[model samples]
Target: MSSTQPVESEWDGAKYGREESTGVIFGMEADQVIFIAVGVVLGVLVVMINGFPWGLAAAIGLLIVFGGIGIPRIKGNSLIGWARIFFRSKSRQRSGNDQFVQKDDGVEIGFTDDGEVEIVEGPEFEIMDGSVRRGDDTPRDGKNRIRPGKPVRMSLPGEFGELLVYQLPGGGAFIYDPVLKVATMVAEVMTEKAFQLNSFEEKEDRLREWVSVQSTIARIPGVDIVQLSDQTTMISGASIRHWYEEQILKAPAVTTADGETVRQAGPDVDPFMHQSLVETIMSVENQPVHDMWMAVVLSKEKLNERIVAAGGGVAGFMETALSMMGTIENAIPTSGAYVTKWHSPHTLAARTRTAFDPDSAIQVSERGEDGVAVRQAGPMYAAPRDIKTYESDGALHRTYKIAEWPHSQARLGFLDKLVFAGDFRHTVSLYIKPRDTAKALKANERDRATWSSNDKIRDKIGKQQTARKERQIQDLVQEEDEVTAGHAPLKLICVITVTAETDRELNANCADLETRAAEANLDLRVLYGQAEEGFIAGALPFGKLEV
Candidate 1:
């Protein structure tokens, strides 16, 4: 009489799953070196003791220490996390899959095969329209299990155009095109072309002004951009030559295809000797890169409302649409500027490829389970299990919610230290939801009225009115002016995610991040129960304030 109940074994993370994740000490696993050192020390003592049995005892102890006990955990966390990371930092990693999704704090890292690593928020959520089925029912690979439906419903009820938001597992969101950003960038370039600033600083300032202009543009409301990054070892000199030979040279006697080779045809064989030496020089640099992607998102309903406000009649709507089109089209470079195409339309497959295998040409419709069904969604699974932290794919992750913004106001570019921190792996994201101009104006007026009412009450109670309220009044005045001048108002949310190979490293990184936050004048609070949701809303590829 045997029971058929499944044996509930504990999650033994020590069971090596991914060969590449096996951590190292200096250049190798710390276990072997530590074992050797222990044996030597014990042998010396045994020799001093002058007993054969003592030597045997020492040998037995060595076996127990080295073979029996692997890397122990410090209260359920990796004890040798630091040593392992030291080795990983010095070496390379190869994954069979195209995408490796990892999350730490408010940062979610999506690594693609093409060396494009994106740090974003919001874990991908299955489509609510019963399109993406919850996968753990059978043996199937988790990659691309949730296929987005064709003719996906536009969630934001905009008059002009719709905004599409994809909720990822890590609480990061991916958005459709943000019209205002396109419009603003075009506007900035045109303004710069009209006036050629001399220095880089001038150009930067001009761009900064354009950024300000973008903040005020009301083309689309509830808009936000999600950014992600992955650290890729830069191409080596030898690898570059090999790629060049394969991709460009083709065969010895073949005439080169145009743009195939860095060296042009005829007399331009030598890249250095050619007229495009500057371009060659620019292209020659090979190094490790932290790839970055900024995804634009906006609300559809708000855009349509703005369009409706432009005119109720069809002619007026058409006129407004044409004007918006003109703004985007005229924004294109007509002069000697670089031309870059927008990303492909296969958003789901494209994102999957970026995350999984860079070379995959799999269509979105073709993507499905790969014979290894997941029990529960990874990021979404571990979060609720742990109170203080979440662990996934052998790495510990936590979410840091932005508790406070800068109290002492700083100028633009104040985040230089935190953003440009060269050491460690991390992701920074800002979610900006635009407010409609008319409603924003009404809110401002209501706020002012409320302030007046509060000020009288305070005066009657014999309390001194604070400077903060006064400043608010001043801010509203400026805000009104900017709105009148076609500037947009946006609600902003910011978060940072830090990644480490183990718990020890994670703890150390938390300290460093805290210090950086203090310097940046940001108050980052570790999310208690909101780890999963925070990652989706703040760190994924799209920004969803609703999370």
Candidate 2:
């Protein structure tokens, strides 16, 4: 179960997963090498046709312009790479995809048949005496005409649009998009024993169990794991006030000497004890609580066969999910966790509302359990951004991706510092995608070929490979061997999102976040120009990344 031994024998340890660079020759990317070769060939042709000095000067100019300016890395990407990103960002902006503005009128928020939001303008026909009438037109019964508007409904921007979320009967939720034909299962994960506090034997057992879980998940083709942590700070007296009120309600009535009924405000001897307790609690500082959720993302077609076999409706989907959930529930230990499934549509609405607008209070609806009015769940306003952070109602969010992980071996709970960094609101998410076994093996062989070619090029040029490159080669060889031995190949990405009510607070939290991540030996890069996508990937149980 253990791949890397612990530095100290008292703890369980594992090396961070590293992906080998696939440079073809002379430690340069394939594109770079191609450009250089093209320039050389052109210069040789010119020399054959013209003269030595002109061709040589042209060749030197091309080398200086292309190889000199484009080869060196800047902020983990080359100049050409940055140019590509810049053009992509500008293209998105020009297409009006970077910003979203909700329709001002409630009458224009209806959805078309294909799930696109329809915004139209027209004069209202007032209903009088049970009939809607227009000037000099025949009056028609209002009940007979289909209303062309959906109340307070608008589509979320980008990939979040056209989403439909359903609460399962037993537990968990199914978040799907009809247009995209993608489905995801989201479930909360209950707290488990602290890995750092466990004994050496317990640590080994835990690691073994985790390996088994990974193996089980890896067997599901085209699957990705999304683990999210939503940390909220409790600075208000709502909990204390609710407790005080509950105590007052539960206080037993006492009969006075005169046989009159008398009820105290609190259970204690002092009638105002609950009030005092509330005040004391309010005086203290805020506390942070973390909620963890794990989501499994899959293509809708993957589950279609099972759903059809089970009879193909809500019941059929539920049955299929229940069977699938058995493996997931056991692996993650979902007991005591709030699974987000509700028997009532009103509850689902409340959960959705809170998910999009954290500052908004959840209002209980009087609607029945039949179906949810999705309009009630969406946020009133959203300001999308192509930059670092965006506003979705009252909160500002900034997301960061783990550009570099710890190179040195550490304890099992090395991420605890980064997760529990500051007392501010934030979320830490991990996305794991298990690769297809055959494809992974083929890719590994191709990488070996590339490395061999690179080695030959380096030897011809009398340049020795760097120590880091040698280590990476050895690691790749070991990984290839492991895959041959039936170990699953996986790609993982870590995203962190920090949330705040204002800019100042958000900046302060982000600074603190960077410090904590550095302590954990993680290099965090802000997901600039992909803020909305990053927020969705990091802060929600939506299995997505900014690539």
Candidate 3:
């Protein structure tokens, strides 16, 4: 076998490390030095003329020479020198090699083949003979390996010409490049998809918790429990509806079966029927299930129309319908019967009956000692003018009467007001009894004679009373306007009572309910007695409550 001599490879130090060389001061080459010196001299001359208190003539002459000639050359040289320095330094630093050694201490020494070095200490270091040094440890720890296919860039420190060497992983380094560091950070963050998974899991847990709370609250008896927020709850029930109906029944123009009008004792009739109808329609459109009472109301054609209108289209319709049903089911009507006249335009007369009775009634008393017609009237009796009559120009006579009318003037006045107001669009009432033409004729005759004799007196008295009433009404209207106009009034907001097992349990239940409501995008409010004095009463943006 022929022995081949091993060729000794040249130890090319240049290939292993960056070259360091000294030239003119501050690392500037000879040509740069010359340019810089010239620039400094020109700058000094200009400064002397502008800043110094030289004689005006000398200053003027210097300014002309420097400003017209010297300044341009100086500036040109300065710019050239700067360019040379920047390019040269950048090129040299970029050309530098990197030396990464895996020390026996499980640390690594990373140095630019130039002169700068970085000491990285850890068990993560790994060496690849003559190729590269890498941190083999997991990325989650502090491994310092650049990803493949990326380039390394270098940057030089200001005023020192010292380079801050960076490893552009796939290629080389450039001066002042931050691209490498930014890329590395992004790569690290991208590896953390596990964190995103954890976040999603947590969110799902919260949602599940909210659903459970909603299910719990829905089971409460007699209470229409609603979740208003994460920390608020609303407890409502059938009593609310009862209150609204009561208000409607008490409205000023309501009439009884006997053609007797009654005034509502409180505020205007509750406007909730229309509102409730609207809500019920909306709920039907949206939810699969609805409150029982709401379904009953929506069964009416007129009510359903109002609901559809209020809800706009399907989504609005669904929301309103569900809310109305919920509210109505929970509401309870007051303990009273509603009596309204059933009128048929096709018929001459309509009638209705009520449980209400006058405090007293007219009855003939047993024969007294005097044997005279003893007028025994109860607390209530017929009015004298209940019978009315008039004669037409062509006809012999005409007559009208309200038989067995109530005795009270207040009651009579109330009935009269309802008639004059004509608020009930579809119906009217009348008292009914057997007609007595003779009695009516007698009364008419007496009235005719009295009126013929005292026309002036009657007109004067009527005028005075009318004027007084008109003035009183005007004052009342003005006062009402003023009270309502300038500022918000102190409204007596309605109260809602929720019966719970206990105060503590109620609060806890409310908190949970509110959480569910928030998830459903519902607004819920919870007011403890402490938030305000006495029972809590308030209004919501979309609905009103009356206790």
lDDT of 2 by residue, 1-547 (tens): 7699544552324466454456666556766677777767776776777678887777677667767765776656656666777777778788977665554344433334345665534322222333223233222235432122222232466657556544444424455555656656666564566667787676666766666667677776435554545544343345445555776777788888899776676544564775677777677544355656677776556667876776654345545665676666665442223343322223334434555566643122112122234444555666554367777878888989888788776656667877788887788887777888899889878877888888888899898888778867876787788789887787778888888888999999999999998898888888776677777778766666665
lDDT of 2: 0.62
Best by lDDT: 2
**Which digits, one per residue and each the tens of the lDDT, describe model 1 over residues 149-190?**
111212211111222333222212223333332111111111
lDDT of residue 351 for candidate 3: 7
Query: What's model 1's TM-score?
Result: 0.46
Task: Report the candidate with higher TM-score, 1 versus 3.
Answer: 1
| Model 1 CA deviation exceeding 4 Å by range | 1-200, 212-217, 221-288, 298-382, 385-388, 401-404, 407-409, 467-474
TM-score for candidate 2, please give it.
0.75
- Clashing pairs for model 2 are none
Tell me the whole-model lDDT of each prediction, alpha carbons only.
0.41, 0.62, 0.26
Task: Give the C-alpha miss distance for residue 356 in model 1, angstroms.
Answer: 11
C-alpha root-mean-square deviation, each candidate = 24.3, 8.9, 49.0
**351 in model 1: Cα distance from truth in Å?**
5.3
Query: Which 10-residue window in model 3 sums to the lowest lDDT?
Result: 346-355
Clashes of each: 65, 0, 34
Candidate 1 global lDDT: 0.41
